[model samples]
Target: MTTPAAADPTPTTGRRAVGGMRALTLATAFAAASGYLVMLVAGRTLGPSDYPLFATYWGAFFALGGVANGLMQETTRAVRSARVGPAAVLPAPGTGGRVRLLPAGLMLGLVLACVVAVSAPAWPRLGLPAFSGVGVAVMAVGILGFSLQAATAGALSGTERWGLYAVLLTVDAALRLGVAGVAWWAGDAGLGFAFATVAGTVTWAVMIALSPATREALTRAVDVGRRRFWRNTASAMLASAGTAALVVGFPVFVTATVRESDPAPLVGAVILAITLTRAPLLVPLTSFQSAIIVYFVQRRELGPRALAGPLGLVTAVGLVGAGAAWL
Candidate 1:
């Protein structure tokens, strides 16, 4: 017979929650620093006009990528939560199920790359300034990298392996810095800065794929319910888009509002201001958002009624943050 749900048998979950918070704190710090570095490096290397354009690349990515991350957060919590049931024994998330998305992720990447390459000429129609064909292609490829990285984050998160998650964040940032440093050296800020993100994420994806745990997760006899997986994926994508609008979609607004040849000094400040203000929310809060999701999921009270109190608090905080960022 299973231990009564009322009796908390595992000290493991409690310990991991505490430890995960620490890792998350560190991860948030790493993400913030690296993101700023990417921005600053591009600014220094690319100069004024190019800076706004590069920022646009990130704006689009993060906004859309939020959905990908949403997928990560929910998947992690759901997968981990499943193991709590005595009969639901399965390979832990980081070990195998993570890579299940790999083939699909790659296909998605390929599709996006083709779209970007094809659309390179019609950028003006998209209202983005015409970038070099290579720059556009690199941008699409970076998006592909981020998709794999985001899913990996979900995998590690599901397993409550905070330390590895922290490493993922730190490594991604550090590698970006290194590659951006190279871009700086090359003095080709535009495409070079784009290269930094692509390189960092590609490597991180490889890192996760090769982990012993991932190997185990794959080789084991697993029971990822087919209907359940697709259902969860659909729900996760919707949540991802909603959450992203709250956080990452700021750039899209900025991109749409500003004219390509507007030549206004305020335009640059607009991008910078949005970034600075959003960082407090996105970097620290959003980066560790899975922790919040997992916490609620574990409690068995994740429904709308249960979430009311916390969501209200988040809304208030978000408003305050927006005002502060605006200032």
Candidate 2:
């Protein structure tokens, strides 16, 4: 008969899995809290009266932001999957890949411009004069800048640089939080909020540039041909857009349909409620996607029956969350 030690092959895998989860839990918590804090500060600063405009732009950002997010998730999965083999070091995603990002980013920028152009004529007629001509301009700039930085984020994800990824996310939140705080204090709440939105994104992108991992990734060559890269990126972006729309589309729609006397108050209330309610559920889900992907990759490394406990815990958490949401 085989002894217990000899029979088991995944010796230390169990510990790694558990330890990974513990560390990820902390990162996810910081990410989640910091994210929601931005919303809280924005809500307090903008107030319900003017918040609907911000909500509209916020929703639009998500809709447009989907491309970057999709790219990041797929890259992460692809990179991590590739590294599961015997190779000790995976090829760092090359620098040339970023040249490809420029066109994609430009395309997104054009889309934003077209959106603003189309909406400009209708905005003032819809009692959104302030937002139509100039407010929309700020939104476009902010979203464009945010989307431009997505490629770097995708590179970070694929390389399994979890610590750097977490730091990037945390800093993004912190920057947004700081911007919101400053806008609120300055009492230029209306325009300042939009400026803060843009500033935070620019700051996040700048911070990521300063990262050693980012610089390293930038030095590498494109892993695949242009045709194949865009093809894959397109599908990933479609899915990402769909997911982001599910979260923000309703707010955008509501704000769009609100009547002229600046029905921002009612629309703002809805946006805030949805934002607050969705945070606990969605933030953790988004934050954990990479970790969950890694978990699957490491499945065979885990001990016998190791997954059972974690799976059970996840199921229990789901049930509790669902019940609470229902209540």
Q: Once superposed on the true structure, which residue ranges of model 2 sit more than 4 Å away at CA?
A: 1-24, 87-128, 218-224, 259-264, 294-314, 323-327
Candidate No. with top TM-score: 1
lDDT of 2 by residue, 175-206 (tens): 76677778778876566666666565574466
lDDT of each: 0.64, 0.61
Candidate 2 residue 320 Cα shift, in angstroms, is 2.1
Clashing pairs for model 2 are 94-220, 94-221, 95-220
lDDT (10s digit) by residue, model 1, range 55-89? 77666666656655655664566555654544544
Once fitted onto the true fold, the runs of candidate 1 whose alpha carbons sit more than 4 angstroms away are 1-17, 89-99, 107-121, 127-132, 217-224, 242-249, 301-327
For model 2, the local distance difference test gives: 0.61
